[model samples]
Target: MLSATDIEVSLAGTPVLKGVSFHAQAGHVTAIVGPNGSGKTTLLRAMTGDLPYRGTVRLGEADIAAIPGWQLAAQRAVLPQASRIAFPFTVLEIVRLGMMASAEPPPERRASEALARVGLAGFEGRFYQELSGGEQQRAQLARVLTQVWDPVGPEGPRWLFLDEPVSSLDIAHQLDVMDLLGDYAARGGGVIAVMHDLNLTAMYADAVAMLAGGRTMAQGAPSVVLTDTTLSAAYGCDLRVNAAPDAPATYLLPHMARRAG
Candidate 1:
């Protein structure tokens, strides 16, 4: 549903990404995972078309840049890591704003449904700034959810980009958000997420793109990408990756930090 071909980026004359290319399929969850400074955030921005990037990015049949800004909002909904509003707006107000760029109606009824989807139903009238970080993240997810559902008509596929979506949440909330992502993909929406939790990615993502030093080191099924060699190289520590006995994927164990912690 979404792809980047030989894409590269630089900030202040220093390259941050070097010839990255990958595709996110429809009805599947794809995750970008790496250590700090691995260009995860840069890649997410490149996907969103907010930053200048070399090479081609295609969202379904049309070039990503060719899509009009207003139209692009309907084609894709983004929940960036920096989804904070300085102005004092109600949670519902912020959610409706996400649909403003959309071509659909003010998503009021849809907003409540979206809030409930993320388990934040009664928080409609709460101030955006008053909520905790995890609550705010769910609020942002509610906004994106409205956009996704709003564009579910003839538009067909809608792309969802999430950058470190679980950074603020406790374990339960993190799982809550991940489950929502899986549900979105299962419903035939395309999901591309930037995640730091390898275990979460393993549990949720159908495919994994391992990025390091601003380049894609590997991209494929979770078991292939989250290997011992790749994890050690990317993280500068010894690690082990083993299959989960109860599941179909691998689980990463950081032996070094496991001992330290």
Candidate 2:
């Protein structure tokens, strides 16, 4: 499991995260959700060791800080919100960068398979600068997948830390990527994602952490955390949550204005 206890972070004397704690278990998709500027991305950055933080972050039994850089890379891969390649690099070349930490067999084959997994089979020869925003996101995901190809590595379980992974994708591709991550978790990998879409979170996330005012407001299963009251309080606006009898998912919508008296 990936666990953080009482994580606190500040940027240039400004507090961004305040005593936030959460666990993302192996074989589950854990999502961090909140309104803009609520520190969801900052929390993710802290967990990934991209930012200095106070408290403990553990990947399984070992403190993440103590783990060697190469070993840590082997165990976890992070897909940031955006990536830019200054020089023109082929898709295959970008994906190949992921294999730097591993000496796994057949490097070319692994990269190709990873591309195929992300629905970019024919993109190997394409230039990174030429792809669309959504395609670039997928290509980056493929790179991370190549990095941690096996969900359960010899060292233990692998992890994916994604920050707004689907923010650039269309609805169909968003679902596709979420389903792919769901499959990764089902196969024993751990996934921690900062998500924006509440409905998608309800459908794809096994656990949800709601953040506001730099603190975790709630954490639990979707049914428990994605409630009308909790969401409204966190977002500072009235909201509605609907659950259909025929479906296992919940839908969130803003409360419409009432007629004037």
Candidate 3:
């Protein structure tokens, strides 16, 4: 299990998160949802040890901060909201960077397999800077995929922590990436993503944590936390959640929101 308790984070002497607690079981896709400046990214960064906090975060039975950096990289890979490259690197070179932490060199096929998984099959020789925004995002995802190739390692179940992973993708690629994440979770891995798309979160996440005013307003199954009342309160808008008879997942209808005044 991955768990955080009483997590408080401050940036530049300003408090961002106030006593936030969250937990996710293995083999599940857990989504963190909140409005702008609601501390979603801050909380995720803290959990991944990219940011410092005054709370306890445990991955399985060990504290995350205490784990060695290489061991941590072996167990989990992170995909940030944005990535920039100064040097012009080939897609294959970028993907191969993921395995730099290992003692032995990684085989060429591993990188190729990761690229294919992200729909970049033969783009290995393409320049990273020349790809479109969505393609770059997919390439970055492929890099992380190669890092933790096996969802479950001998140490334990590995993890993927992504921040707005599909933010740059089109609808088709968005669904494809979400399906891949779902498949990873189904294979006993853990996925915790900071998501802005409520409908996607409802469809893909096994659990949802809603944040408002730097605190977690609700955390549970999407059906329980994605209600009209909770969503409206968190986003400060008159939002509605609807289910369609033809579809299996719930969808958000932002157009149905009325002026609150």
What is the lDDT for 222 in model 2?
A: 92
Per-residue C-alpha lDDT of model 1 across residues 130-207, encoded as one tens digit per residue? 999889999998888787673344777787899988888999989998998898888888889999999899889999
CA deviation > 4 Å runs, candidate 1 = 150-152, 256-261
Q: What do the candidate models score in CA lDDT, each in turn?
A: 0.86, 0.93, 0.93
Q: Give the runs in model 2 whose Cα sits over 4 Å from its true position.
A: 258-261
TM-score of each: 0.94, 0.97, 0.97
Model 2 alpha-carbon miss at residue 168, Å: 0.6
Please count the clashing residue pairs in each candidate, in the order shown: 0, 0, 0
**Candidate with more favorable, higher TM-score: 1 or 2:** 2
lDDT tens string, model 3, 1-261?
999999999999999999999999889999999999999999999999989899999999999999999999989999999999899999999999998865566787999999999899999999999999999999999999988888898899999999999999999999999999999999999999999999999999999999998899999999999998999888987788999999988999864425433
In candidate 2, which residue pairs clash?
A: none
